[model samples]
Target: MVAVYGGRGPQTSNIQIRSIPSVVRRGENVELLCEVENEPDAAISWQRVDGDLPYGAESYGSILRIPSIQGGGIYMCSATTRQGIFDERFGLVIQEEFKRIVKLFIVNNISHSTSEVGKSK
Candidate 1:
């Protein structure tokens, strides 16, 4: 007796972000990578979940590049194949350099003032 078996079909699964910075500086270029485990021909797409996509953002293959990361929000990547579709989300937190310096100054001044008040008492 002879038996015939069919090969497995394309499937989109184990979608993940290969690399992404936890914190991105304003006006800096950033690249986010999305990977699928089994499907090499999967089509990848990107979308912003929390806000509008940054200006000049584009996707090449499985990589999403932002010419300049202006604002911070949730970004999602979708991988589609013949068998199924998978998605993964990434959080992009943006920090402004000037804002950080100003915030530090304000916090230091507040602390200094509080210490002075306690000493006076």
Candidate 2:
């Protein structure tokens, strides 16, 4: 991740978050990832803009797990190193309707093959 810190920030190795756009079905597995890299490790914290968070959910590195699919909104992660704490925020929107679009594009290439088979038959 490439990130910018303000006002006497820490000497971070890589201060950036990778962009991950997930398209998942409801009642299934979904994982959202935000990563940060720094020397000597950094203290990381996560907070959801809306909704509740599961208890005892902390990791050694700058990683957070949603565990289950649920409602979504903006989320932010901050890292505190020897210099200063750097922060990054990202928006997430979850909707069932969009799952169909994902299914169509990701899975149903079968339609194209079926049409070809029909022509041969």
Candidate 3:
């Protein structure tokens, strides 16, 4: 198999990752979309930063879906066509303090009235 594009005519292919904000909260589902354009058939593989091996799929491009966010890490996708193989990686991080603040706000709202929480001295 060819690593890069190798065809009769000029070969060209592009791969990109599309999704919402890079920073996401834990327990949220994230969909990683890979868009690719090439000749007839192309192979795509997606793996997390700590992934073991690559999984293969047939098509110009594809999407990798994450059911829920467990931890912070990076994700990668590699595409191989008649032309060539290209790889890209994306990173994710958890904002623990910010999330904690949000949780606190939610708890306070449920337990106490806003006026009580913000009473005048």
Name the lDDT of candidate 3. 0.64
lDDT rank order: 1, 3, 2
Kindly give the stretch of ten consecutive residues in candidate 1 with the minimal lDDT sum: 1-10
Give the per-residue Cα lDDT of candidate 1 at 92: 82
User: How would you order the candidates by TM-score, starting with the best?
Assistant: 1, 3, 2
How many clashing residue pairs are found in candidate 2?
4
What tens-digit string does per-residue lDDT give for candidate 2 at 6-104? 577733455554436645444544444556554446777777656555344444466666655555666677777666677777666565754344444
- The 10 consecutive residues of candidate 2 with the worst lDDT sum are 109-118
lDDT of 1: 0.78
Off by over 4 Å in 1: 1-12, 99-121
Clash pairs, model 2 backbone:
1-16, 2-16, 3-15, 10-84
Provide the RMSD of all predictions against the true structure, rounded to 1 decimal.
Answer: 12.7, 13.9, 12.1
Residue 48, model 3, lDDT: 79
Worst 10 residues of 3 by lDDT: 52-61
- Regions of candidate 3 where Cα sits further than 4 Å from its true position: 1-10, 51-61, 97-121
Q: Per-residue CA lDDT of candidate 3, range 9-62, in tens?
A: 545566777777788776776777776765336577887778542233222347
Estimated TM-score per prediction? 0.68, 0.54, 0.59
Measured by lDDT, the strongest candidate is 1
**Candidate 3 collision pairs:** 4-83, 4-84, 5-82, 5-83, 5-84, 6-82
